[model samples]
Target: MFYDHADQQAEAMHPNPDWTTTPITPELIRGALDLETTQHGVLPHRLPARARAQCTDPQLAMVESQPSGVRLLFRTRATTVELDTLPTKRTYQGAPPRPDGVYDLLVDGRLTGQATVTGGNTVTIDMTTGTAEHQPGPPGTLSFTDLPDGIKDIEIWLPHNETTELIALRTDAPVAPMTDRGRKVWLHHGSSISHGSDAASPTNTWPALAAALGGVELINLGLAGSALLDPFTARAIRDTPADLISLKLGINLVNLDLMRLRAFTPAVHGFLDTIREGHPTTPLLVVSPILCPIHEDTPGPGAFDFSALAVGALRFRATGDPAERATGKLTLGVIREELSRIVRQRSADDPHLHYLDGRDLYGERDFAELPLPDELHPDAATHRRIGERFAELAFTTGGPFTGHNA
Candidate 1:
């Protein structure tokens, strides 16, 4: 069935015998943590090989491969471009099919075209049943033609929330890797907020928006629902090439109740320790959780608010009792306090390190006007707000991320 469908599409592409088919290698893509070659094409893993081996959590594996902030950055003189991809589209049983992942094409840092790939595959996930079924289909090609071409920097941004397997790239003219424009690479790690959970598109994610505003390259490590302070993630941060780095912590820990303050305190220390190992003097900012009213005082292990779901909508509520906070259990309010303390204490010895209360990005008053739609993740407008705030706070002169006096 796969071959049968693929052959039909191939015939269309073959009609233009002069089209150049180029192989996609690591050089062609940016923001992907790892690349694995497959018979169909290349599978880009946002987590590196070593990191992948350490954790066997299916959730982590799935989210990282979504390629939210990853883009195929290149320079080409072509007037037309075609990309083949096999995307694993998700369905929630009774829920309506999520919109197809969007491919955003940018020329010279400006939006030029948008596309969506058909065919490919589908993975239906039944949360109620706790099972998933994969149905394979042939790769589909997305074509964009007619452009004012005279050497342009092109960025093909992958879908924000879909697992995509890139198969091939074709163009009317030759393509080459885009030359490094001397932009500082900002490596960021955070929760679903940074992952673009409800973002309009991949390029609209907070990190991506901030990167655009700050004139920096983004390597997003914002894994959805899997930002548990894993040792492997810390090591990846330590090893990655980055001029500026930020770690957004706390929300995932509180929502999952993965550990108590006792374990969390040391885990935060250990995570920073590992990162400091590689870039001892890098500008590393430890950011606390953003303002989430649900988990502000109450502890969590957030649960789906079934009442809201019954009306064909998804909503979440903090399930952990507020009384649990009397013990070592964690909450956003508590985590913010601890993170600020830890950074203040650490910055005295390590000047390059900094502390940023995530509330500074999106706090109480702002929540009244721009509420988090899901009571958890920020909406598109909030991402823009956070991105603008981050650029003003971190990239401005005299900021921690900007060059400062020792």
Candidate 2:
């Protein structure tokens, strides 16, 4: 007997007949701006479909689907829960094999369980040529049994780095959207650091940790390698419902060597302008890049450290000349200076606008103590440090997110 695709998928999801299977729906998800229906299941997207349609770059497409801060939010009395997912795992030709992405399950705001899905699709990337080939695989299930008995809020945080297509949610009891707890909503946008590169788990990402500490609901638009101050991204921020907002700028612009200092200033202005169109008086904070020694003075087009690559390790170094800054070449120093000036100028007429030095989150002192492992992304310990520092700086009494600005 032959089975169709849907039948096979259904069979794969329902291996244990006793559990009540529930279709994953919009209300059950948070942090994702949109969801795309696929043959296997529903894929969450950080950016809306309209924004995605505007660009065909594969990097942007892949990062948005990775669901950096996305999670399933519900309240249930279930003692056991299982979710079927199709994850697209990535691997570079020469580097060490990447670990399976983790799913963090939170019970009533506390981390109670964690699991990783296996046997999903894989994408092999050629680091030298920047080409990628996809190979399909089977779906996998993440099961968490022996949850607490009482009715409690449940949050299953999707992997911060993997492209996960959620297929089904099964539990011993019924579930419903978790009731609001009166927390402020924080919507943040930034580069890979904010996307949780090297973070231990989804809930351990800096934004996630900071949100937890700040007592706010989080909506992370932290697109890896794609926070290029694009108009559509700004529009997405403009349209998203956020009580507090932040934009972490500079790193991606400098590293991609995407523009000159001349183009960079106006791009920052236009991006802020678009956000203010909808969020006219919302508390908006502009954050500059963290201290990256290599790119601090040197212009980029950051390149992989071929020496490290030869030993099967991953590392990056700035490739552009420091002298090129004379011809308007962009560097971290250039971007940070420009961002500070822009925010200061904009804040004159907009009291709600604020500025933050990203170094305050992860500074030179912190770097000396816990340097970036890849010279690009923060490690798990650094993520925790940044999260703690962010909460202290931005969510505390005198911080921008604490009170309304006149």
lDDT for each of the candidates?
A: 0.86, 0.90
Which ten residues in a row are the worst by lDDT in model 1? 1-10
Best by TM-score: 2
lDDT of 1 by residue, 232-321 (tens): 999998988899999999999999889999999889999999999998998998889889999999998998776776776777899888
Which residue ranges in model 1 land beyond 4 Å of their true spot?
A: 1-15, 404-406
- For model 2, residues 1-406, the per-residue Cα lDDT tens digits are 1112333444557656766777888899999999999998899999999999999999999999998899999999988787889999999989989999989988999998888877789999998999999999988777787888989999999999999999889888888887677888899999999999999999999999999999888999998898899999999999998899999999999899999988988999999999999999999999999999989999999988879988989999999999999999988888888888998898889999999989889888999999999899999999999999888888888999886311
| RMSD to true structure for each model, in Å | 3.3, 4.0
Task: State how far residue 344 of model 2 sits from its true place (Å).
Answer: 1.0
The true-versus-predicted C-alpha distance at residue 153 of model 1, in Å, is 0.9
Candidates in order, TM-scores: namely 0.95, 0.96
How does residue 214 of candidate 1 score in lDDT?
84
Clashing pairs in 2: none
